[model samples]
Target chain A: MALTRRDILVGGVGLAGLTVSGCAGSPTTGGRPIPVQGATAPPGSPNLLVIFSDDHRADHLGITGEVPFLQTPALDTLASEGVRFDRAYVTTALCSPSRATLLTGQYASRHGVQNNLSAWTPGTPSFFDSLAAAGYRCAYIGKWHMPGDLPDLPGVERFVTFTIEEGQGVYRDCPLIVDGVQTPRPGTYVSTDLTDYALQWLEETDDGRPFCLVVAHKAVHHEFEPPDDLLGTYDDVAIDLPDEAFTYQTLLDRNVWEGTAGRLQTSYRRYCETLLGMDREIGRLLDAIEPVADNTVVVYTSDNGYSWGEHVLTGKRWAYDDNIKVPFIVRWPDGVTAPGTVSDAPVLNADIAPTLLDIAGVPIPAAMQGRSIAPLLRGEAIEWRDEVFYEYFADFPYQVPPSQAVRTDQWLYVEYDRGLAPELYDTVADPQQQVNLADDPAYAATRQELSQRLADLRREFT
Target chain B: MSAAAQSGAGAMPGEAARSGPVGSSSGRAWRIAAPAVISVVTFLAIDLLLAALVGRPWGPAYPLSMDALVLLRMGPVFFSGLIVWPVMRARGATRAQAVVGILATPLAFAIVSGWRAAAFFPPLEAAYYSTNPMVVGAIGSQVSSAGVGALVYALWRARRHRSGRPVSSGATPLPISTGWSWGPIVAIIAGTALTVFAVIWDGGQHLFYPWVLLYGSLFG
Candidate 1:
């Protein structure tokens, strides 16, 4: 059989054949059925598309609770069909590092990546590498925040990149670093252009092969701008005032609105408007995939939660739920036997790697810190990893005192090594965490237990 | 460089379908390169706009001049790092087709250099370490004292880059037919030596010496 450059160049046609013909069907070469995965027909292996939003809070979702007029029908459809974890968290609450955690399935500290600034060059293997090793053609389509001398990803094909480099505001026609050359997308909004590229890949690439496509959305992030078409979609929804946001203003008398750092500059109205485009974009995306959605498993979650009038902080990197909790919903109509089961149990963002591999029927590596949640999806009884740890390294420069905590079934213990006063809250008793239990003598045993556990977790993290 | 920023991120859309104003009858041939060129122009326009916005918040431009020179200075380091991937790729590197599959660095460095060099130099420091004013002051004062000296080493890199050529394809190593293989390498080494030796007359210098010269010339 002759292999021509034309076969490879067929991708130049945009709809290249993904099927690798089997030797079993060969007329001349009589061989036993040498089976293949993505060679032909429908992809025997499932496709995984993880849509990660940067600095987006879980509560902002319309389906999560009462929200200002926010439309996320596509995401809502995902929640209705897949197992939506109510409590999902990032190890480090920064952009690049959190992204690293998702790739590495390890905490930022463990991965040797602490913050967005400076070099966090990866020596560890990313989940994409593992997927590639398992014969999946992986691709990252948007929002690559991994800073400084990015590792040459072996198996992962980065078709496009929205830089996480500083001062490169996440806005329209933002310089997209593609194949290493910093170029631009032809559109008014960067998100729209990114989605366009994403859909193009979907339409063009042969879906027969198992693929890991990550579409990291830049909208619902800073200097918020929604497309003009969807600006009126949520213009009337009454915004729910979060408890942490209004009360925390007292702590910032010294640094009121003048608060300057790497904090997300967002307003209630602006954030709502910015998210409108994402909601509709999400809707449109689901519409495109809904036709042949059986084989595809779409995982929707944010890199880290953002504060919109929450804690008056205006960004991530707090022990508060507003910062850590992300909306995690996985939709696999054919894959999951039980589709609409909601799991309130704590799930770590790190779990994403193992879970994906489990669903793909690939073996989870021992090096990965995350455990698979495939059982939860299949409604199988499984032992859960209780007491998930939380971490927040200062994103705004010069702010030391890294924040760390451990959240169990009932308790939320936070230790602030940075100058902020440490606090403990009974999430079960006071859902809002309105009362501080760190100083109360009545809560001594709980405090001691939490403190020791937090210490032990720290030791484990190191 | 600042002119690029004025375009903003949302410079235009549908550049693919709409042909830009072509002056010559050779428009048909030029149209073939149009999509690639249009995409690049749109992306750079956004980058420039973002850069401009950043400049407003930070400065006029985040110059890569000295840093480019520094990277050029650390050509050995960057190239050395490049080997890890090439070797790893040769071995069991799982991901076969990376965006920066060896050829990206040169292209990226060239783009960063051609656009942001000179003006974007002296990468933001005073604003970065705003933990305490002392850290800020220390960095600012350091910038003041160091000035062009901060970039002398990076400046020396300009001569080296002038000698090299672009690797046209992502698959192959850049051909070395145009660059001064031995002569310019030695000349650069000598030139760097003389500059450092001159700085030593005052005191030992840091990396910012070249940038300090720029500041001095501007002020004087």
Candidate 2:
């Protein structure tokens, strides 16, 4: 059945009603939370620390070697001591949709955050609900850009996020909403301030019960404002932009669409500098968790990848690799048997919730669409997905068409709405996706198969 | 004793020499080009001013509302005719020449800025103009604002004529009896067609494909 605009609005209201009524928690199981397949964790479960950044490209990390000049020592160290899924991507390449997918372990369609304008369906089951029920203290920190106001999540004991500037919080002196109270932090950078709050929670939460903390940073997003000390860190480095980038692409993009002003190279340098600032904060959080490192799980990733002029685009929501792929590194000393293992298995943002739930020995909810990669982390032989599906809904005021794509180890197939032509690329031959093979006779069979598979995945997930 | 008659009789010596018949090709060209130049300058001034106000000076940050910035940028385009009208009168243009100059201001501003915007990635351009509400709103604002500005200028000129007040520092007003020529009309039509052709050529399928879809849905 086709979902009309009315259906979406009604569904949102119904979900909000459920949230207000506190229907997420059950009275029967004594709140111990029975797992779908196995026993729930007891009092002392491993802590889960998920450090999520905004718009950090998959290749910008120092460990990735994709950008040699990029300096991200903290992320590099984390990857060195963890498992980096080199091909991890978000199901949706927009910030709100991808973040919703991360929390819900479901696609944007199922979660009802199909665009930035849509909010998280209030009663939707998140890993936080499961973790909270299973004797874990959960907290969501930093930027919540999803519309319909900052949600009152049942699972989160503390919600430290901002609503200033319509949830795209300022880079400096950002206000904070700490557990229902508005607090102002004057002259503090957003990344540093958010990380400081995360550290404070970690130090103050002294209960023997484990904790689930999401430190979602707003650094590296648009405006690309780095902290004062790291502002000009990458000013001298030569920016390696794609050949498709026009001379005035970034200038027109900023002045017209984004309503800002900057050239490509300057904006890119500021983006890298901002990432460096976030990296320093991540280093602080890493140090804070060192005492409990053995019994903790640390996952580092971004909401979505940003484009620095690749395909002549400057922002996210495109199905291109620069917009969808993200840096996914997991370090769990107690869970991951092998350190420094770079897995070739494709992962999605949807998998993060299920994986964290599985690590905490909490029940992976039956409604969750993603499969936990816990066995893979344990170095156990397990069957994994061969391809990942991606979806992006059209965001108003931003001109990117609604698109769906299926990416495998060897190919990527994309279909767009509004009568736009489909795109198909042989990943092995064209990693940059410069050529479209949808109409090529030699790749006709491959395109047909991938198109069918994409349809199948969409039906199955939604 | 109309305002135009008073201005003609009280003309300064230098103004009398400058205010000649609109039939001369060089004089007509200047009349057309002057308002167009003024329109472009006004637009650029507004764009730059807004950029400085909301945009971060030391870095590549714009922490303010984007909707406000975009709306503010449209202000100069809408009132462009009024902004260029005083300059047209100061140049001692005939009534027909002044009307042409006022209409040309918004057209020139729209075409120049639209061309720059269309130079973005073809697919992005197509997607943006694909029946997007913002595009519709912007176009509507431009047309209506220019129309309103022209109407106000015409009303003010009529009121001044009826009251028999001199319009400005008096220069000889060219005769309104000057026969209408096809030159300005042909130029406007040719300029619009060329811009359309250039945008279509540059944007290719990315520009045309979505419009085809929209047209098919609307008409068929």
Candidate 3:
């Protein structure tokens, strides 16, 4: 049948309206249980697959308006199919510290992984162990930047992690440690290779027991390198620099603004390119798990938020929003009914373990600092913490001074321990944090209150 | 130059003889162009106001002061004005037409620029944060400037009327056919030099430095 212009226009509009209204179909749930011999498992223990990316900021997602032209269809599809947390943050913006928080559900101080160099001694309790104890099979793949001497862990039966280029992991030709065995990879793209192992495990794992899989991608990090196929996809696209880039008053003393601004476009383009490759791999993973998708609780997030000179600084050690805020999207078909939902309630990397345990009906350890946000995911009203504590103990020789901050919904109080002036921002009014109200007489009362609250938080967490 | 010398005294400047002003008698161009210019100016003013309120820096920090930041923010808007003025003048727009264009700058500036910004950031969030006094103050300056522009145009017209000169399109024909002007040629040379310096000194991102900065802020 021949279609008229009006018909086409109407159909287009209708399709767009549906997408905007989140008309994506809900996943199937309550399937027949897979029987396991000699296992005392709860009726429907859903599988868990956590897809973690390194140094990815929250806004970088296409839906977040980070880079306007960058299209992350896979991630956008995931958010539309699940719940996206708008205020998700990391305890520390370093790789190891943040990863440790995800593992232990505790702050850096409690976990003893204060810096990137600090190691988590083998047998230190993680929620993975709890899942294993509850008759679930666990596997970890890709950039396991968590510090530890032993390649083996309590629950992770398959440990396929990359360790090359001083633990940053290489984009290409990277070596992998597969269950304590050294494997040389020649000219293999790291993310693709890691996914290969993860899919293999997902396919070969004993079907009786529910599984926990971690797939971490080392894309979109510093020295941004995309796969060969994606290298020139964004070469012609123009990037709009921010207004602050012109008059970078914050970097005037350092003489680094011009240098940073000049290379910003090339660096950011490479970043988007790399992210695209990762997104493609994620789509493949989703395809591979299509049958069990509804019964699996899929979580996607980053170890830490990264910065490409938002504050005239490149890297993630700072207390800025871009450096600490991370994209957090969780999809559990059986449990979460509110599809395409956005949660403004504060959540942290430390909350991952407790929440996963809660999902699996396991008891949260008393030692865990984070409370499970399972109720929040189910769209239930639950009393939640108003503030999140953030700490970055000095990377001493690197000159990154130690700082602790308490970020409430309205206020942000940062105290630098190196005798630097404190920073206080009324986030509701000044989201970009241009004006520091720390020393302002008008905000003296608010400052004191936030300071006291911060002190109390430090005492509670430490 | 030869065209202006041949035409009568009422002829406007800076044009080829045949292209002085199209359809001047019907006033169609002025009717179309006047509101458009006013709308743009008003939108830019509002954009600046919202920018101040949001306190959102569009790009990375540069090595410039607060005053410099303010100037850089205003630069593009002013540059657009430079292009708009000559077009309206050449169209033989009346004093009232020019006044309407000038006076309508702030609101138009806010609406247009605000719309553009909303595409990148949430409109409500952008507007909510833009409730700063500094943004209001910036809007005030824009409105005041537009008011001043209208006043100047009115005063000039009144003076011409009092002197019994015909209310002709005030544009004067430029004498470019005789010889090239030193001013524009020198500007072109300077601009070329600056671009060359930008390519060599500023990370080689773009040949034109300001364009690089502008593009970088919007999409980078």
Candidate 4:
């Protein structure tokens, strides 16, 4: 008989049922799942806990010393107890595309989620599938903002997410979908509510099998709505607006270009407050998993960085450091040899999946473009890439142009489409990228070299 | 003589002699229609100029960008009533007719252009503009400014009528009046002060810092 989609789906479900039942008997085999015949992971594989935040810039953390007044004790503690990647970035600075890179361990160009409007490429191999096939239970709980309807993602046993406001879930009282069932959660803050679901899943599914939990928070993204407790937390804090942000022309330009309504200072305060709320929830999750804290690998990072009045721009998707850089913190007492160590080697969001899979003892797929940073965590002195590549496709209705960039230790080169002038900044001399050296005769050789390197990297990656 | 001509004979001297067939239905329609057309043209001209200044391409290619541009454009629509009020009053319109013409400017512009915008954009995009508090506030600001302009016009006309001076014909009349009440003056002062405050407070440190430095030099 010819097979239909329904038949395939039902057959897959039946196979999954059989697999679950087979593993049910050996749930508690020496603090790990017994190698059920074809299982890939051995005994004592660590549980994976990934807490992903939205639009969190690299310098926003209290430990970064960039934002002195912004208090983020929980993230500071996590960084102090684990490895913090000092030069972490997203290949694409938008939300959906960067998230797709995280899932597939591939660039946005390969994954086909190049913009916020694009959905995950169906049938693409994800780390979740690899981990599940290797005898690990995985649950994804939080904001799933890809454009197409919430996907029936294979290998994710529990899919708890929301689809309101085009998947940019509300900060308060966001309705959720738990295991494909509509669940209303009224008066619950989204950050707290998602963490609660993560904790609940962790508690109920503690069957001695290693698990992967992703708790993605919708805080610090648009509307800048913090919880009631943190609403006025930063109102008294003085906001030092950038020099470029002090001009009326800059304010008018940003207001029209980015659709940002209020004062940048006020919106930035609310953003910080909302981030604090998200950090509080992260602390709660950390406290809940204290029993297995030593055995659990917690990875905390944001999908992308946000530009807060940097270069007179508000919001992300630019090739600037404020937009492409993200805060990457990983904690695993069992795996990482050196705690409180910071690696200055550049890392991309695409590296996250392969790194997690490597930590879980799953073989890294050959197709994943990102390299696992397991050696860096182990304090092994290995050769790493000296520069990072960044790409941003212009999403509709946003005035930003499509651009590609390459950032090295000393220089940052950016090329724009739509006839805009390319930009080159000497990071050693001007960290804020105030002076453009693209047209300067002095840096002509540097610009040419970086441009060629960018072209080569795009060809090699794509 | 026809009834229209007979009625025109008894009308105000400036009103009957200013233009073509002043008492006819078409003339009355022109009274409202002309100002509405002028107001929409003025709005479009300003939008086009601002779009050019901002380097926004002129098309429906990007709906949200256009929506934001439209919202920003609405901030200056307050000047539409201010611009048209004098023209309507100079053309022998009474205070009621002038106010009606000024009010209908924004209403007519919104209905016509909003319909065109909706046709080109998606329903969700339209709904975003309608439901956004900032966009709603812009609309409110436009209407309130027009209302204030009408009230000012009415007060000026009342003061002129009480002083027994003939309203202008063919030339725009200044809003100057003798023995004018304090209500409109207070309202004007309060509105101007609020506008200045909003610009300074929300305009980041550009306008605010200058005022701060000035105050410090003067008093600090």
- Clash number for candidate 1: 33
On DockQ, who's better, 1 or 2? 2
lDDT of 1 at A134: 69
Candidate number of the best TM-score: 4
Report the lDDT tens digits of candidate 4 across residue range A1-462.
122334333322112211122222322111111122226456888888888889999999999988878988999999999999989989999989988888889988888888876667556788888898887878888877876656677667777787766677788878776665556667788887787677666655666678888898887787778889889999998887655453222234234334245566778888999999988888877877766788889999999998776666688898888888899999989868889888888999999999999998899998898989888898888989999888887564354667889999888999887667999999889987878999999989999999999999889876
Docking class of 4: incorrect
Return the TM-score for chain B, candidate 4: 0.44
Cα lDDT of model 3 by residue, B72-154, tens digit? 44443333223333334445455445434433443443444445434333455334322222223334343334333333443
Q: Write one digit per residue (lDDT tens) for candidate 2, span A1-462.
A: 122334333322111211111323222211121222222458557889999999888999998788878889999998888899989999999889988888999999889899766766666788988888787877888888887656676777667787766577889988777765566667788887787676655555655667789999998886788889988988888777666553345433232344223466787888889999999888877766666777888999999998776666678888889889999999988777779889989998899999999988887988888889888888898889999999988664455768899999999999988778899998899998878999999989998999999999888887
Worst 10 residues of 2 chain B by lDDT: B170-179
Clashing pairs in 2: none
- Pitting candidate 1 against candidate 3, the one with the higher lDDT is 3
Q: Compute the lDDT of residue A111 as modeled in candidate 2.
A: 90
lDDT over C-alpha atoms for residue A2 of model 4: 22
For TM-score, candidate 2 versus 4, the one ahead is 4
Q: Candidate 2: how close is chain B to the reference, as a TM-score?
A: 0.43
**Candidate 2 positional error at A195, Å:** 1.1
C-alpha TM-score for every candidate: 0.60, 0.71, 0.62, 0.73
**DockQ scores of the candidates:** 0.02, 0.06, 0.07, 0.05
- Candidate 1 ranges beyond 4 A from true positions: A1-43, A164-169, A232-237, A242-266, A398-400, A418-421, B1-220
Residue range A58-101, candidate 3, lDDT tens digits: 98888877677787888898998899999999999888888778
